[model samples]
Target: MLSTESGEVNCITMFKSCLRYPFHLKVLWLVILLGCDSNLPHTNEEDQKGQTALVPQHKFAGTKTCVSCHTKEYQDWQGSHHDKAMQVADSRTILADFDSAKFLSNGVLSIFYQKDNKYFVQTTGRDGQPHEYQIIYTFGIHPLQQYIVAFPKGAYQCLQTAWDTEKKKWFDLQPDLDIAPNEWLHWTGNAMKWNTACADCHSTDLRKNFDVGSETYHTTFEEINVGCESCHGPADKHVTFYETNAKGTPPPLYMHNNMRPKELVQKCARCHSRRAQTTSFFDYKGHFLDHYDPSLIITPTYEPDGQILDEDYVYGSFVQSKMYQNGITCRDCHNVHSLKLKKTGNALCLNCHEPGYNTPSHHFHKINTEASQCINCHMTGKLYMGNDFRRDHSFRVPRPDQSVEYGTPNACNGCHKDKTPNWAADVIVSHFGETREDHFSDHLLAGYHENLERLHELISNKTYPEIARATAMYYYASRISPAEVKKIEKFLNDPDVLVKNETIRAFSQLGLGNYLPQIKPLLEDPVRLIRLSALEYVNKYEPNTQRTSIYQAAEQEYMTFMDMSADHTSGQQRKAQYLEAKGDVTGAIRAYRKAIEIDNHYNQARMNLALLLYKEGNTSEAEALYLKVIEQEPHVSYPHYMLGLLYHETGKNEKAIEYLRQACSRTPAILRAHYNYALILQQNKQYDKSIKAINEALLTFVDNEELLYIRLVAELNSKQLQEAYNTCLLLVELAPANPNYQQTLQEIKRNLESN
Candidate 1:
C-alpha cells in the first residue's frame, strides 16, 4: 500500500478522472464503496447462528467486548455509513479539496485550506466579518459532505456550504435562499447548530445536557457515531448474561431480537424520522410517538394528498403506507447489520410483490426502461440538498386525479415533465379503467378542501390506517361546529392511540370545556403521549381538589417530559404554555424568554410572549415585540394581525385597519384575519370591500358563524338584500337552534320581499 498522503492524492486524482454520475448509485450502495474493516475478529460457527450462550458475570461491556463473539456483525458495521456518520476532521476522513479551494457565493468569497494538518475555512463568521475558523469535524459522507465548526459552549454548527462528493464541486446546500449574516437561517446561527439539531440522531446515546442556567451545552455521548449499542440499546445486562454463562444457550434479553416488527420499525424511526425527540433518552422500544413526536402529514410539510413536500426524511411518509399497515418493516428489506438492501433494485421489492408487478403489462411501460421500474412510479424520488435524491417511502399508487384537482404532483407528472396532469389522468384511466381505487389521499384532499362529511368518515373509519385517520382528524378538528363536536367526543376513546390522541386535541380545539369528564379518564392512559395531552386539557379546569392527587401525578409526568426536552426551543415553549395554563404568568414569561434565547428566530415563542405581555397590560412592550417580529420575519402574518389587534385595542382604528388589511393580504388562508378585516370594514361603512373580504374568508372556512354574521351585516348595510337573505339563510342552516340567526333570516326575508 502507498503512504497515507500518497493514497489521498491518488484518490483525488481518481476523482478528477471519473465522470460525474448521478448521486443515487453512491447513496444506494454506500456499504460497497466503504470497504469492510479487517480489525474486527472472526466469529465462530457457534456465535454466528445462535444467541450468545453466556450469562454476564460483569456489568455493561462496550462494542469492543462483543467483537470477539459477534465479529461478522461488527465487521459489517465498521465501515458502513453509520460508522462514518460523524468523525473528527483528519487527513484520512476529510473528503473536501481543502488545498486552497475557493468558492464565491453571493459576493462573499470563502476559502478552504489546511495549515499544520488542521482543516480551516476563511468565511463570513457570525459577526459578518471574514474570519478563519477551524473545521472540527466532517458530518456525513457520499453525495455531499459538510464541515462542523465548533463554537463556544460545546456548540457545533454545520456549515451551509458543502462539498458535493459525487460531482466534485463546492455548492451551497441552501442555494436559492440567501441568508443574511446575523439571520437565524445563517450557517453560523442557531438553525445550523449541530448539538441541538443533529447530535442526538448522529451519535449513540447522546445527552444534550444543556445547562438552562448558563445557556450552554455539556453534551455527552456513549459512542461517537451510531454503533452496535445504538440499535441494540444499552447491552450491559446482555453482556453480563453472556459473560456469566459461556457454555449454555441463552435467551435474548437486551438485544430485543424477539421484538415485534412494529417495535423494530420504531427503533429505526428514532433516527430515520423527521420528528421531534420529546425525551433526551429514547428507550429504543415502543411506538415512535411514545418517544418522539412525529410530524403530522400537514401543509408546508406534506402535499394536500399526503405526499412528501419537505425534507421529512421517511417515517412521516412510511407510517401512511400500505406496507407499514400490512406489518412490513425496515428489516424485511434491509439487513440490520450492514444497513443495505438484501437484494439490489427491483429484486428487493419483487421479493414481496407478485412476479406480474415486474412485467410491462402491469406497469404499462416498455421492458428494461426507467418507466418499468417500480420506484419511478410508486416511490417517486425528490432531490434534496441539490443532488441527494431520496425516494418517498409512502409507496403510494400514482394519483394523477389528485394532482389535477389539488395541484399535487403525481409520479407520472414527476417523470413525464412534458405531460399535463390531465393527460396523465386520461392515460391512467385508459390503462387501469375509469374506476379509480379508493385511496386515503381522497379523504386527505377532501379534508384539505374543508369537506366535513368526507373528513368525518375518514376520522371515524376504524379500518383505515391510524396515521391516516389521525391526520384526517387534525384537519377536521380545525373548524368543527358545536353540534359536530358532540359527535367527535365519541372518538376520544378510539382504539388506536393516535386517533384517541388527535380526538382529544380536536376536543380542546373546539373549546368545549364541558367535555372534561370524558377527557378525565385519559389522564391515567397507558400511553404517555395520551396522558400528557390529557394533562394539558385537565390542568385548564379550576380547583379540582377531589382529584388533586392523580392530577399532581399526571402533571409530574407532563413536567418531566417537558424537562427532558427543554434543550429544544419547542420544549421551552410547551413549558411556557404549561406554566401559563397553571396561572404562573411570571414563570411562563421566563420560559418563553429562555426559548427565545435558545432560538432567537422562534416566532411562535415571540408571538406567545407578546400576547402574554398584552394580556398583562404591558401594551407598549407587547407592541414593541410585535413590531420587532414583523421587522425580522416580514412574511409571517401573525405579527401583523397581533399588531392590528394591539392598535385596535389602543383605539388607533386607521392603523388597525391598515395592519389588518396587510395581515389578510399576506395570509389569505387565515380565517381570523379575513373576518377581523371584514368586520372593521363593515364598521367603517366600506360594505363593498367588507363583502369581498368575507367572501374570501368563506372560501377557506365555510359556514363560520362569526364570519357569516359579519357578512350578513356587510350585505345589509350595503343594501344587497338578496345576498343578505342568502347569508342569513346559511347562518340559520348552520345554527338552527340559535334564535339570533332565526330572527336575522326572517328580517332579511322581509327586506328582500319589500325590495
Candidate 2:
C-alpha cells in the first residue's frame, strides 16, 4: 500500500493529468469524491511503518509586531530589496508594461495586457496550448522581475519570460535553453513550480506543505513576502517576555540575539547559500546542517580555484574567504536592516585595510578608477540572469598564474578581456614580483588529476585553510591509499567544524570497519552535523552486540534527520541507502519509490531502484527501468553500461554487446564498457575489433594497468607480435615494479625477436 503522503500526491497528479482536457468540472468532481476519506488519519499499520511527518516548530509574528519597538530599523527595512521581494500583482507592485505589450522569444509571441483591471499573460500553457494566464504575483524587484501564474492542482509556475527591470523590456530568463513542451524543465513543468524552487526563501515562515501522494501543494506562509521575522526568527517569545515585564526593563536574552559571528553567518547562509533544504524551514537555533546541506566547492557551481561560476549567492564563496577564517561575518560590511554596504565602494575595504590601499601607487591604477576598487581585483564579478552582475566573495589575491595553468578565471583576465591569461600572469610578475607558488588552486588542480601525494601534503599542512584541506580530503576519499586513512584519522579532532565534518564523511566513504572503536565516540559528539556523520559510519561498522544501546540512540537521531528531509529528493535517497544497509528491504524500497515520485527524472534514484529490483529477482522490472532512464538521458553512458552489465549477468551475450557498444560510442566513452566489449569481442574470435576497441580505451586510460594487460592479450591472440610487445612495454611503464608485467614484457620481446 502507498504511504499517506504518496497517496495524496497520486490523487492530485491524477486530477492534474485531466486538467488539459477543458475538464475542470470532471476534475472537481473527482476531487470531491476523493475527499470522502482524504482527511481521515492513517491506519495503525501506517502509523507504525510510515516515515515521520514534519511539524512546524515556530510561529511568525510578522513585521508589524516589531515595528513599534524597532522604528528606525523598520523604516530602513520598509523600502529595502527584501521588502519588495514578492508582492501581489497590482498597480504599485507590477513593474512590466501590461497595456498590450508584445514580446517575442524562441518563435513564441507572448502578449502582456490588462483585462478588467487584472494582469493577464498570453503564453504557451502546460498543455502546449496558447492560453491567457492571470498573473497573480510579482516575483522580484531589481535587474529582472518574473510573474507567477496559479494553475490547477495548486501549481504556481514562474513564467520563463521575465521583465528586465533595468532595461524595461521583456526577456527570456533562459535565452539559450530551448525546452520541449512535454519536458519537465519547461516553464510549465515541475521544475518551474514556485512552491518547490523559489517559495521557501522568498517568504517568511513558508511551509511548502507539498503532499507527495496527491502530487499537489498547499503551501502556506506567515508573511506573503520576506519580512522582519525571516532573519530574526519568530518574535512572539521576545514580545511576550517584554510585555510581561510591565516595567519595560531591557528584554531578557531573546531569540538569536546573542548569536556569535559564525552563528550569524550561518543564519544568513540558511537563505543566501546554494544549499539543499533538509528541514521544511530553518529555526535559526540549530547548526546549518541541522536544517540544510550547503553545497561544497564542487564543479559547475564554482571554478576549480573556488571562484563563483554560477549564482552560488555568496555563502559557498564566502566560506572559502580568509575573512571568514579570520572571524569576519556578513554583517561586518553589510547593514543587517538595510541590506546595503556600510560604506560604498572601496571605502568598505579601507575600513579594515590601510588608506594607502585606496591610492594609485598601491593599486597600480588611477585612484578613483573602477580598476582601483578592492573588489574589482580581489572579488571580481560575473554577469548572471542576463545583466545582474554579482561579485565573488572568496576574497583571494588575483592569481593570473592559476588561470594560465588550470584554466580558472582571474580578476586580471576578468577585467582585461582582450588579454590572455599568460599576458596577465606576466603583468602580475612585473608589477608585484614573481607569483607565489603556495596556492590552494595548485593543490586542488593536482587533486583533480588524482595526485594523492600532493593531496596528502595539502591535507597535512596546518597553515592551509580548513576548506582547502577538507576539499583535498574529499578528492582523496575516492582514490584513498591504506596509509592515508591513518593520516585522515588525525583530522577527526580538527579545530574547524568543517574539517571534522569532512573527515567523518571521508571516513564513512572509506568504510573502514577497523576504525569502529575510534568512530563510535563521535556518535555522541556535541555538533549535530558531526554526530550525524559519525552515526552513518557507525552504522556501516554495526559494531558489537554490547554497543547496541549506543548504536540505537545515534541511529534514532540520524533517522530523525533523514525523515525530516524526506520532503527532498536527496533526503529520500540517503534514507534508502541507510535502510538498505540496515537490511530493511521493504523500507528501502519505499524510500527509493518516494524519491522517484518526487522527481521522475531523478536518474540516480531510478538506477539504484533498478539495481535493488535486479538483486531481488525482478529482472524484467529492472530492465524496463534501465530502458526508461536511457529514453530520458539518451547520451548518458552510465545507464547503458549498467544495462550491459545486467545483460551480461543474465547470460544474454548478444544484448550485452549491443548496449556495451552504445556505451563505448558515447562522448567521453565509458572505460569499463570499452574493456568489457573488447573482452566479449575477443571471446567471440572478433580479434581485429577487440584490438580496435582496446586501442580506443587505451587512449583515455593510457596508464590503466588492467586495460593495458587486456590489450596485450588481444594483440598476442591476434598474432600481432610487435603490437603485443608495445602493449607489454606500456604495461611495464604503468606498473614498473610488478614482476608479472616484467615477465610478460620479456616474453613479448622474445616472441617479437623470433617473428
Candidate 3:
C-alpha cells in the first residue's frame, strides 16, 4: 500500500507501522498479527475460509431502543468507557479546568476558560496565532481527555493540549513539537482532525463523506459516543422481533450468544486494530482483512522482535496471543458490556492456567508483590496517549536472551532497569534452562538481520505465524539473486491469504514478467484483499483498455479503496500512483498537487511529483520542489539522491556531485548514492576521490557488487593496474555469473600481466 516508484514509502511515517506481536511462538504460540507486513495464515483458515459477505444493511435502533428490553446489559454499558467515549462539552462532562486555567509547552501558552457556560480554549490555531476557539465535544473518559474544535471546511480538530485526568493538570501531547501553522502535525492539521482520526472509533456508524475535489469533510455519525449498535449489528431488526412478540421470527439474524472467538475479535478490531481502512464506512460484513489492512510486526511500529513500540489499539497484539489461538475471545477475560476484566489478578489467569502456575515455584518471586503478578512479566505494559497504561495482549514468557543480541525490550529489563539485558538473559537461562527451545522470534530476528537462509526457510514454514513468514517474504523478495526471487513464485499459492496477498504485492514492485502466468490463478482468489493485490500488479504491468470481469471488479474495489482514503495525504499519493498505472499522467499530477495542498510537508508526494515533472521536462519546477523538500527535511537522503540523478541527467555535473556527496553524508546509507557519486567522480577523472568514496561506503555497507564494479572501472581508468586487477578479482569471484564483470576481469588480468 502507499507505493512509490521505489516502493511503499511514507511521506510522514506515522501509524503506517503500528502493531506489536509476541516473541513466544506456540508455548511456541505466536499469534499472527493480521497486519499488511512489512504489515499471517491458514492455521487460521477455519475462521477466515468464507467470511466475506456484503455489508449488512440494517436500520439503527440506537442505544435507547435496547434500554427497555435489555435492562441488565443497558445498566452494564452505562457509565462504561463505550458510553462515555465521547460527550458534548458541558459542566458535568468536561474534565479540564476551564476557569481561565493556563498551561504552557513548547514556548506557547494556552488558556482555557468557560465563557457563558460554553467551553473555550485560547491556543495557537491553524494560522499559528493565539486564538480563542469554542469546544464542541469532549473525547475519551480515562487517562486523558481531548477537546474537539470545529474548524473551517467542515473539519473538526482534536486539540493537542489535553487534560491529564490522573495528574489533574493540563498537558500538551506534543510537548516538544514546534511545527509551523501549515505543518501537518500542527494542532489544526489533518492529523489531529477528529473527522479522520478520532470520529470513526469514538462514535457509532461514522460516515466520513470527504469531498476530495472540494477538500471538505461532511462527516456524520449515528450517535455521539460508541453505543450498543457499535459492537452489536444494528438492532432495529432485533427490536422489531421483540416488539411483534411473534414466534418463528428467526431472531432477526444477528450475532447471538454463541459468537465464535474470531467473530468477537473482528467486532472489537473494527475500532481496536492499527490498520489501513479499505472501506469508507464499516459494516458487519467480510473478514477483518476485507475492511482493513492491519499493520504487521514491522520496525518503527513494533520492535524487530514484535514488541509494542506504538499504540496498536489491541487487535494486532491480541491476535498473536495463545489465548486467541486457543479460541479465547475478549469476553473470556473482559465483560462484553462493561468492558472490565472478568476477574482480578491471578484468579483471572487461573481460570485457564493450572493451579501449579500460581505457586512460588513457577513465578520464582515473593508472594503478594508486583514481581509475583503474572501480568508484570507475561503481559508487559507500556504507556500510551500520555498516561494510559496498556499491557501487550500477546501474552509471552520473558525472553531476555533475544534481547541480549537484538536489543529488543524484555519484561525482565523493564522492571530491572539497572541491570543489562545480558545479566537478565543469564538469570533467565539459570531459571528456565539454557535451551529455551526453538521460537519463531529467533527466525524473525534472523530474517530481519538479512539472514537469507533463515528467511528462505521461514517463507515456506507453516508452524510459525503466517504474518511473520509473510514479513520474511517482504524482506526476502528484494533479493538481488535470481535464485532467491525464483524461490518465491511457489508461495504465490500460499494457503494463507495474508502470505498470498503479500507475495503478489512484492511482484507488483518486481513487475509482471515471468510471474505473470503464475499470478493468473490468484485473480480468482477466495479473498477480496488478495484479489485486489493481484489486480494492482496486473494493472500496473499489463495495462489494458479492454478488461475481463474479474479485472473490472478488482479495479472497482481498488477505486473504492482509493476514494475511501482520498481525504488522507497518503490516499492522494496512492490516487496519483493509481492514475499513473492507468496511463493517466495529468490526473496523477493533479492528485499529487492536491496531496501537497492537503499537507505541504508530505515529502514523498513532492519527491514523486518532481519525478513526473522531470519526465515531462518541467525541470525548473521539479528542481524547486526537490530544493523545498531538502530545506524542509535536511536529514532525509533519498530526496538528495533523486536530485543528484536529476542533475546528472540534465548535464549539471557540479550540482549533481554536490547533492550526491550530501546524500552519502546522510545517515542510513543509500547504496546507489555512493555508486553514482563515485562513478561521476571517476568520469570527471577524480580517481583518488572515487576510490576513497567507495572505501567509505564499504565501511558502512557490506561490499556491494555495483560499488565494487564502479571502483574497478575507476581503478582501470586511473591506470592503477594492480588495484584494478585486485578489485576485478573480488568482483568476479563475488559474482561469477555477471558476464560484464567476467569480461572486465579478463581485460584487467591482461593489462596487469602486460604492465
Candidate 2 structure quality by residue, lDDT tens digits, 1-755:
10112111221112211111110000000000000111222112111111222222344566887887889999988867788777888989999999999998887779999999999999987677889999888887888888988877676888888898888999987788777666556677656777767777787766665565675666666677778877776666567767677565443221345667776787788778887664544544456666565666666567777788877888888877878878898878998888899998898997798998888777898878889889889988888767789999989899988888778888887778999999999988987888585667688876656566788888787677766777777766655534458868888888776677777777665555677777778766666566677787666557333456655666666666675456555667788877876778898788988877756676677777787788788989989988998997788776787788788778798998899899897743444567777777776778898888877776655566666777677777778878877877877786789887788778777876876
Clash tally, candidates in order = 12, 11, 11
Give the poorly placed runs of model 1, Cα more than 4 Å off.
Answer: 1-60, 246-255, 284-287, 481-484, 510-512, 542-549, 632-636, 703-706, 716-723, 729-755
Model 3 ranges off by over 4 Å: 1-56, 249-254, 359-362, 478-484, 511-514, 518-524, 665-667, 684-755
1-755, model 1: which lDDT tens digit per residue?
A: 10112112121112211111111010110010111121232222111111123322222246687798889989988878788887778999899999899998876789999999899999998888999889887877878888888788777788888999998989987778777787666878666778767777777666665666676776766667777776776677666667787666553543466777676777677788776665545544345565676667776677778888777778878888989989998888887887888998688898999989999789988987888888898899778877888889999999998888889999999889999999999999998998987888898798778777788888888877787888888877765655667768788878988889888777666555687788887777767688778887776554243556666666766766787667566778788877887789999999999877766767677777887887788989888888988987777666787788678767899998999888887742455667778877766889899888878777777777778887777777777889888888888888899887787778777767786
Model 2 poorest ten-residue lDDT run? 26-35
lDDT of 3 by residue, 1-755 (tens): 10112311221121111100111111001111000101011011112223553224456777888888789999999988889888888999999889899998888889999888899999887777899999888888788888888887788888888899889999877766687778777778777777777777887767776786787777777777878877776777678877888678444333567678887787788788877777777766666777777777676667787777777888877876767878998888999899999999999999999998888888888987889889999999888767779999888788998887788899999999999999999998787888887666788787676566787887788777766777777666553344446778878878877788778876665443467677765666767688667776676667673587766766777777788788777788788877887899999899999888878887677877887787788989989998998997788776787788778878898998999999999843556677778877876889899999999988755567767777776777778888887888898788888787778778777766786
> Any idea what lDDT model 1 has?
0.73
Q: How close is candidate 1 to the true structure, as a TM-score?
A: 0.86
Root-mean-square deviation (CA) per prediction: 13.1, 10.0, 7.8
TM-score of each model, in listed order:
0.86, 0.79, 0.86
Rank by lDDT (best first): 3, 1, 2
- Ten contiguous residues minimizing lDDT sum, candidate 3: 33-42
> lDDT (CA) for every model shown?
0.73, 0.71, 0.74
